[model samples]
Target: MSYAEINGLSLYFEGHGSGPGEPLVLLHGGFGAGETFAPVLPALAEQRRVVLVDLQGHGRTADIDRPLRPELMADDIAGLIKHLGLGRADVMGYSLGADVALRTAIQHPELVHRLVVVSTPARRDGWFPEVVAAMDRMSAEAAEPMKQAPVHELYAQLAPRPQDWPVLVGKIAELKKQDYDWTSEVATLTAPTMLVFADADAVRPAHAVEFYALLGGGEHDAGWDGSDRPAARLAILPGATHYDILHSPLLARMVVPFLDAPA
Candidate 1:
């Protein structure tokens, strides 16, 4: 366990494994913590130093008076890499974390060596209409019903003040409503990238292919030897959904190789 004082927040993170290869930083989704990757951490850490980050307002990290923007969180990640003396790292994030990871690579390309984005779209409108509708309804009023979520239990156990759960919910709701389109940044992204998502994720399947095309992927068939293939990889896990993809072993299987591959 460690705390990196970056910007105005004391970001929390934990180191796993001490094996060879570049360190891989793992970021969890909204309302989730480093523990969100708990099941696969051991496997991912087997051959790479995995740093699990708890984004601001999640887990042990306390919230400040700021909007929960991916760009801001990405900055915190960039600072964290510097503070930890890692120089550069391979970053992988799920859902909300995926948005932050994308921003990290875009905002500070020098700080990220490679990226694995899981279950998130390049544009805000990439989500299905139903998902958008659900997000639209996210509010403090839903806090009581949300207690059944695992995130609530974890927050209750680790948050400095459990009663402030509604605050986190409100911030996330506001963030969900905020419009953002990173198509330009993503189209020009310089980092080697891999996109992972469930076949039945909240994002539109066609948009996934489009995102890959922007990254110079899914355009040409790799040679029999894979010598002509682009560096980017796109995997849509079968029989998986956005909700359970994080805990899926398949996620670790796909992520480990991409982060370990030489660019």
Candidate 2:
């Protein structure tokens, strides 16, 4: 367990394994901590150092007075990389964390060598109507019944102030209600990026293709010799949904090769 003071937040991170190339920095989804990746962490760390981070208000990192915004959280990640003296690193994130990862690559491309965005959309509208409606329904009241859920249980065990669980829940609810669109930013991103999604995801499938297109992928087929492929890549994993994709072993299977590819 290590904590770095970045952007006025005491960001918590754990390091595992060690190999070559830039370290892999992982950001977990909302209501989760670095432990969220426990199921696949070993596979991801086998070939490189993996840095698992608890984003603002999650895990052991206490919340501050600021709202849970991706842009601000991105700055914290970039600051953390610099603070750790990692000059540049590969970043992978899921769901809410994916939003921060995308923004980090966009806003701090020089600090990111490779980016993996999992189970998130480029725009708020890219999500299915049902998902958006669910976000609208998120509230402290709605979170009451969820105290028995694993996410809340983990919070109770690891959070600095377990009583703040409802506060975190309300903050997330407010964060989800905010709007954002990063299509233009994504289209201009310079980092090598891979967009990962579950076949059954909260994001619409068409939007995934559009997200890939913004990254200059899926516009054409690779030649027989494989020279026409774009720098960006896309994968929709089988038998997975947004809820369970992070735990699927296939997530590591798909991510490893992409991160291992030569830059």
Model 2 steric clash total: 0
Worst 10 residues of 2 by lDDT: 137-146
Shift of residue 65 alpha carbon in model 2, Å: 0.5
Clashes (candidate 1) = 0
Best by lDDT: 2
Error of 2 at 114 (Å): 0.3
Residue runs of model 2 more than 4 Å from their true location after superposition:
none
Candidate 1 residue lDDT tens string, 102-202 = 99999999999999999999997889989988888888788889999888999998887788899999999999998788988898888899999899999
User: Model 2, range 140-198, lDDT digits (tens) per residue?
Assistant: 78678889899999999999999999899999999999988999999999999999999
Which pairs clash inside model 1?
none
TM for every model, in the order presented, reads 0.97, 0.98
**Alpha-carbon lDDT of model 2:** 0.94
Instruction: Tell me the whole-model lDDT of each prediction, alpha carbons only.
Output: 0.90, 0.94
Stretches of candidate 1 off by over 4 Å are none
